[model samples]
Target: MKARLMWIAGSLIVIALLGYGGLSYALRQNPHAVLDTVDRIAGPSGSVEQVAEASTGPHRQQRLLVYRSDDAAEALPVLVFFHGGSWAHGDPQHYGFVARSFAEEGFVVVLGGYRLGDEGRYPAMLEDTAAVVGWVHANIAKYGGDPERIFLGGHSAGAYNVAQVALERHWLEEEGVPESALRGVIGLAGPYDFYPYDSASTKAAFGSAGAGAESQPVNHARAGAPPMLLVHGEADTLVKPRNSRALAKALNEAGGRADTLFLPEGDHNAPLLSLANPWRRDPLVHDRILAFMREAAKVSVPVQPQTP
Candidate 1:
C-alpha cells in the first residue's frame, strides 16, 4: 500500500511539472496567440463593437471595443476593463469572454488596448487607458451606457494600472475627466503593493519612472478615492494575496469604501477566468463585482449573496 501511494504521488508531480512546462513554453513562444486560442475556444456569447481609434502616444494608436446587451434602449452602467500580461503584451480581443459576460449581466463593457512594455514605458499604458476612459465618457451614451456611471476594472498588471488611474487621479484629470467620473474600481489578482523593482518585467516596465515606490498603488491610496473591490486568489503563486489585502486596508484606513474577496482554491487567473463559460470554482467573483458597481451607481437591483 505504501509503495502504491508513492507511485501515485510521483505520477502527480510529473503531471504537474509537465503542465507547467507546456504553459510556460506556450506563453514564451507567443502570449497573444495563446490568449487568442483560449478566447476562440471559449467563444464569447455577446456582440462587440469597435467604438473608436485613439492615440496611445506619438505615432501609435489603439482601438476600443465595447460590448453591449441586446436590449440597447435602456441606459446601463458602463465598465471599462483592461487586460493583464505583465505590462508586456495583451489585447482587448483576448478578453472578449470577460466583456461579453459582463454585457450579458446588464452592463455595457468596454475593453481598451494599450502599448505593451516593449512599445512604451511607465505612463504610456496609463495614458492609453485614460484615453479610452475619456472616449467612453464622451461617447458611451451612443452605445446605451450612462456617462456618469462609469467603472474601471482589470486583472494582474491591468489591475495595477486601474488602481493607479483611479487612485492617483492625475491621469484621468489630464484627459479632462474628474476622479468623480468613476463609480468604482475592481482589481483581480492585482499586484497593488509590489515594489523595489526586483523582477526583470518590473524593471523593464517601470525602472525609469523615478522611484519604484511611486509606481505602486498602495502609496497613492487616500481619502475620497473611488470605492474598490479587490479580489485575490489565496493559492495564487504569482502575485501574493497580500497585495490586495494591503490595498484594501489602506483604502479603508484612508476613509474610502473597499471590499476584498479571497478565493481559497483559486490561482492567479481564476478570478478573471470565472467569468468564462459556466463559472466553476470562484463563482461569486462576477456577482461581487456587479453588486459593487450597482451600489456605487445607486441603481437598485436584487443581488444574491456571494458564494463563499
Candidate 2:
C-alpha cells in the first residue's frame, strides 16, 4: 500500500510541473509576442527606429520602421498605423509586416504603441493617439514622409481607437493638430460601437457603455470628418460586421466619404495578413487601401518628394 501511495504522489508532482509549464508559456504569449513574431517573419530588411513613448505615462514606447522604396525620397504619403488586440493586447510590431509591405509600395509607415488595459483608458488612448500624430507631423520628414498626407488607421481595437480619436477632435485639437491634418481613416475589423462593459476589462477601459453605449462612432458621425475606409470580415465572431456597417451608414449620412468592404467568408485574421501576401489571391486589402489613400491624398500618380 505504501508503494502504491508513492507512485500516486509522484504522478501528481509530474502533473503539477506540466501545469506550471503550460501557464508560463501562455503568459509569454502576450501582445509583445505577436510583435516579435512579425519581426521574425519580416526580417531585418527595413530600418527600424524607436520614436516615442506614451506621452501620458511610462507604460509604453512607440516605434517606427521605414522600408524605403526606390522612390522613397520624394514627399511620399504616410500611413500612421495602430495594431489591434482587444485594446489590451496588440503592439505595433505585431503588424510590422503590414507596415513594411506598405513602405515597400512607395509610402512611409509609422507604427506606434499605446498604453493598454487599466494603465490607460478612454481619453488616455485618445491622448496617446494625438501625441503620435503630432510626433508624425513634426518628425516624419526626417524619415522621408509627408506630414500633409497623413492617413490614420488601425486594426480591431486599434481601429476603434483611431475612429474615436479622429471623430472626437478635442484630443487632436488640444495637441495643436488641426482636424485637416489627416487625409483619411482606415479601420479593419474594429468595434466602433457595441461596447459591452459587462466584462471587467471593457468596464475598466471604456466605462459602462450601458445606456450611453450609443455614443460610439455610430452616434458621433458629423460633417468635416475625414473619409473612412472600413474593412470587415463578415464572419468575425468577436466583433460583429454590423459595427462597420453602422459607422459607414452614419458617415455617409453626415456627408463624409465612408465605404465598407465586406470580405466574403473571410474571418478577422486573414484580411490584414493577406495584405502582406498578395499571392494569397485574396482580394488585395492593401490595394484597396492604396487606392483609398491615393484618392484621399489626391495623388493621381506616384509622387516621391525630395529626401531631406
Candidate 3:
C-alpha cells in the first residue's frame, strides 16, 4: 500500500509539471498572438530600414531597426531601448511594439538585445548596454537618427539596466561617453534599488549583498545623472509601486528632474504590454512618459495626452 501511494504521488508530480509547462507556453504564445493581431490591423505601412551589425565586442551582433518619416538621412532624435525578462528570457523582438511606437512618433528607435542571466552578471549587463548606446551614437545618423537626442528606456529588468547605465556614470565614462551624451531616461516597472534584498524575489535577482540601502537606486541619486521618468502600476504584484516612487524622490532630492506615473489598478504586465493598444491606453502613463521625453529633449511640441 505504501509503494502504491508513492507511485500515485509521483504520477501527480509529473502531471503538475506538465500542467505548469503548458501554462507557461500559452502565456508566451498569447502575447505574441496579441501583438500579431494588433499589427495586422494597425501596423504602419512605412518602409523602415534595418541594419544588423556586430558591436565592438564579441558579446552579440545587434539588429538596428531605423524607421524614418523622410528619405533624407538627417539627424533626428533617437530612442534607445532595452528589453526585460528578469535577466533571464527576453529578446529585442519581444518589444517590437514599444520600439515601433517611438520610431513612428518621429524618433529613431533602437531596440537592442543583451546577454541574459545565464551569462555573467553585474557589470557585464551594464557593459553590454553601454556598448549598444555607443554603437547607436556612432551609427544612428546614417539612419536619420540624431546622435544628440539619445534617450535610454526599458521595461522590467531592462528598466533596471537603463537606470544602472544612466545613474552609474562610471560605465559610460569608461566607454568615453560624456554624461551629457544622454538626453534622459525612461523606466517602466524597473528595479532601481539593489539593497535590503528584503523580498525573496528581489533577493533572488540582486543576491544577498544588495540588502543595504546603499545598493538601491536611492543610494546613487545625484544631480549629474540625467533626468528620469519612472512608471509603475499601483496594483503591480511583481514589482511594487514604491520602486518608482522612491527613485523619483531620490532624483528630486538630488535636484534632478524626475517624474512618475502610477497606473490605477494596473498590474506590471498589463501596463507595459498595453503600450501596443490604443484602447487600453492609460493617459496618465503615456502622456507623462511623452512629456518627460519632450522635456528631456527640450522639444517645444505639445503632446496630447491619451484618455484612460
Task: Find the candidate with the highest lDDT and give its number.
Answer: 1
lDDT of 2 by residue, 162-211 (tens): 89888877867777777766888889998887755555656767773233
How far off is residue 175 in model 1, in Å?
0.9
lDDT of 1 by residue, 183-213 (tens): 8889999998878887777888888565468
Residue pairs in collision within model 2: 73-305, 74-304, 74-305, 75-304, 75-305
Sort by TM-score, best first: 1, 3, 2
| TM, every model | 0.82, 0.77, 0.79
Which sections of candidate 1 miss by over 4 Å? 1-61, 280-282, 299-308
Error of 1 at 200 (Å): 1.1
Computed on alpha carbons, the lDDT of every model, listed in order, comes to 0.76, 0.68, 0.67
Task: For model 2, state the Cα shift of residue 23 in Å.
Answer: 19
Best by TM-score: 1
Please state every model's RMSD to the true fold in angstroms: 7.8, 11.5, 11.0
Runs with alpha carbons beyond 4 Å of true place in candidate 2: 1-57, 61-71, 196-200, 208-215, 278-283, 299-308
Q: Mind sharing the TM-score for model 2? A: 0.77
Across 52-97, the per-residue lDDT of candidate 3 in tens digits comes to 4445566553333444555534676888888777776666765667
Clashes of each: 0, 5, 4
Q: At residue 35, what lDDT does model 1 achieve? A: 44
lDDT against true structure, model 3: 0.67
- Candidate 3 residue 102 Cα shift, in angstroms, is 1.1
